[model samples]
Target: MDDQQVGAAAPLAPTERTDYAAADSRRLKIILAGEAAMLVAAVLVVFVLKIVTGTGAIAIFAAIVTINALIMTWHVRVITNRGQHQARQAPGGK
Candidate 1:
């Protein structure tokens, strides 16, 4: 591919992640807590359903998938918010 083509495929510099761990400290902890709570809730729900219905392995697999989806959605939101936060802090964002 030509340089222009390659450049087009690359993420914009502003959205390119330099650090995954950087964000408002307090907010980051809150996000972590929320994510953890979600994980716990998902697992608890799956386990409870399995026990109540005797659904066995399928229920466990469903729980894993559900929990993974929840976590992934949360992660995407966190990243987007973090990027927006960073952008707002940037001089041009104002």
Candidate 2:
């Protein structure tokens, strides 16, 4: 083929596309489920400890559970934000 025809017929470079909808949906569902499970377990444990011990023990257990919940929430938020930022910076993302 002529130089012009060869150049014109050259294949295009591969382009990247982010399907945010599917990925975001899946990630959100998983995060929600995990958070819910963690909260439920924490509540159950606190209740059990309260019943087995007393008011003072319940208070301590509740404080620990609250701290755990906060930590988990912060972790999830940080991870989610990082994923969103990366996706936005990716090629073809707006």
Candidate 3:
């Protein structure tokens, strides 16, 4: 085989695989951190409201529902966008 064919058939280098793994890990960490931050902020808001307004269990329940809804919305949007992007990159996509 010619040099070009040989090079094209070569598997990814160890460093290239490592780089892809590291990037995926970093992205996962960042996403988790953002989610945690949102939950923490929601807890803090609920805590302060409970102390000041003396709102009961319903407020906490509402806060949990709101946070879950927001998270679900975010995930759905991300999934949709990723699907659209992949479709655009597929063969014969316009």
Top candidate by lDDT: 2
What's the lDDT for residue 91 in model 3? 41
Worst 10 residues of 3 by lDDT: 2-11
Cα lDDT tens digits, model 1, 29-73, are: 767777677767767877787788887747676767677677767
* Clash totals in order: 0, 0, 0
Sort every candidate by lDDT, greatest first: 2, 1, 3
Least accurate 10 contiguous residues by lDDT in model 2: 9-18
Give the 10-residue window scoring lowest on summed lDDT in candidate 1: 9-18
* Candidate 3 residue lDDT tens string, 1-94: 5434543534445565556556655665677677777777777777887788886746685868687668857865675565455445444434
Off by over 4 Å in 3: 1-14, 56-58, 65-94
- lDDT per residue, candidate 2, 11-91, as tens digits? 322232245545665777787788778777877887887788766766766787787678768867876786666556554
Q: Each model's RMSD to truth, in Å?
A: 9.7, 7.7, 7.8
- List TM-scores for all candidates, in order: 0.43, 0.55, 0.47
Predictions ranked by TM-score, top down?
Answer: 2, 3, 1
Error of 3 at 31 (Å): 1.5
TM-score comparison, 1 vs 2, better candidate = 2
